[model samples]
Target: MGTHQLTTINNSDTFEDSICDLFNHLESTFTYKRFGKNGHNQKGIDVFSTEKDCAIQCKKKDLSRKDLLIKKEIFNDIEKDVNKVINDDLKVKIDKLIFVSTYKDHPEIDEFCEILKEELNTDFEIIYWGWDTLESKFLANKELLNKYWSNFIIKTDSKETHFKRNLDLKKKIAKDFGNWLNDSQANRKLRSRILLRAFDGTQYPDENEPDEFGQYSWFRAEIKSLYHKGMEFIIGIDEIQVFEDYTWDFTSNDNEPKGELVNVAKVGQINFSDIIDYDIDGDEYYMFPHVFCKFIHKGTPFENIYYYNLDKTYEYFEIKDKRK
Candidate 1:
């Protein structure tokens, strides 16, 4: 199951509405409603279930924008919301207060909630629901999942055929890009010159070997060939190691380079499943799949060399070095 589906909700209001809808569907006895217009004067309550005397506060935090980690600010916000709900006037007295967040569950957040409950010494029960809980709930309810995250729908006959079609389209795209890369003019323009960022896996040095700076290094390579090996798409390339003094300036047409030629041809496996649809210079829009190349370096297999499809101008491929 894709637990990251909920993270696609780009706004706080939508997230709060989703939480409200989820609880209303899950609990048949309770009927939840949005507390106020645009959550103004809500008294720390975004959703309220009057029938069950329950109050829910939704916290939407985009971890991607916030360095992909839960911080103390979230905990502090939760504490403040809990306090607001406890020490405020409302139409109906709430016996239960629930805090819902788009963030994944963390040990520190769990422990903090426990501490808050103990210190508050309230008669009502306090509950915290993170992304894990939301994901499980959405998985169980097809309608809810489809309503909120349309991308995570279950595969039916038609859906399965659509997925297969997308895969076939990606294969064609890869083949086209491979052909373009092998062209004489394209080869002359990009060979041993295009610098690509390396993939940083979850497990640091174990899964990916970084340079002395504790970060992945950009690599330059020339595509030798592209083919399908079993269920994987493989790219054959001759890796180039650039010198320390080599200045990477794409604006200038300087042909000189200070890099060593690594004549060893390596077969790297590419991932075509992750596709991103974006616009270029606010004009042209296209769907581009990320090319994750895993090749063996110095006898150790390293999953580096990230590539993406750039704009094709007059049968030549232009390298757009933008980190998505």
Candidate 2:
């Protein structure tokens, strides 16, 4: 699980419904219902709770689409809504009026709310629930978090440890792949593509010029062997294709061989397990799981590869000639 952030709900109706659900979750004793459609003649209240004598006016605003900074116009809008609730004649006596907004909290907004509260001189309590407050309540309840924002989840201590362990395992697999590329001396070749960061004097040796178009370049290279200096793993290639003049071609008339340092993070999808010789007669053959590499700047390399583990089962393969 990863850290959670409350994303803006694009649909205004959906945002109101979610806020209703969140209200119910927070005040379990009270059942909150959505007020009339389009705010109609039902005053400024968007949601209400009869049991709690509470009324909430939802303001769905996407600050990202607008200037992120708080403005005077928003404060004016808040004042108008508060006044509507104060003056409107309703069936139930509203003891609490809350203004719920998707906007992130700002000190100016808080000061404005306080000033409104003082000037109103109303019997009911005036409250403002901003993005920060909503996020805290959503995180406290997993059901609300999953229902509204499912992309990211709350990270507990045990889940955090598991995530760290999985990351470490992926790093180890990358190092092991580099070693396998070096030790597999057999004349077997795997057709693969890799994305390389532009020739930087600090990271990459100045053997090739910097790409004219961008900071990253794609190369179709044959994985021949691997060499390492400390933590850096350099890959040796024989047939190299460079992108030039809007086409991929061999460099110069004499197609020379070259070596490139592999950025472990940018390693493309080359299933080393596909080339393994399965030994059925040997002891229990443990198959390593396939790791789909995520390139930094490029789109997904292969769409056919299933990136998710749906069944939660570990499938193993037997390696007949396991390289040392």
Worst 10 residues of 1 by lDDT: 278-287
Model 2 C-alpha lDDT per residue in residues 1-324, reported as the tens digit of each score: 344466777788988898889888788854798888783886878899998899888887756443223355567677887777767776767788888788765666778777788887877777787888887777788787778777765566575685565555545545655544544434333322222222211322223322223322223333333222111112332222323222222233564523221111112233222121212122232222222232222322221221111122312222121112
Q: What is the lDDT, from 0 to 100, of the residue 105 in candidate 2?
A: 58
Q: Could you tell me every candidate's TM-score relative to the true structure?
A: 0.48, 0.47
Error of 1 at 102 (Å): 1.3
What is the lDDT of every predicted structure here?
A: 0.55, 0.53
Winner by TM-score: 1
Over 4 Å off, model 1 = 1-7, 66-69, 156-324
lDDT of 1 by residue, 125-223 (tens): 777888788877877887877787777645444656657755785676555555444566445544323222234234322333453345443333343
Cα RMSD (Å) per model? 12.7, 17.3
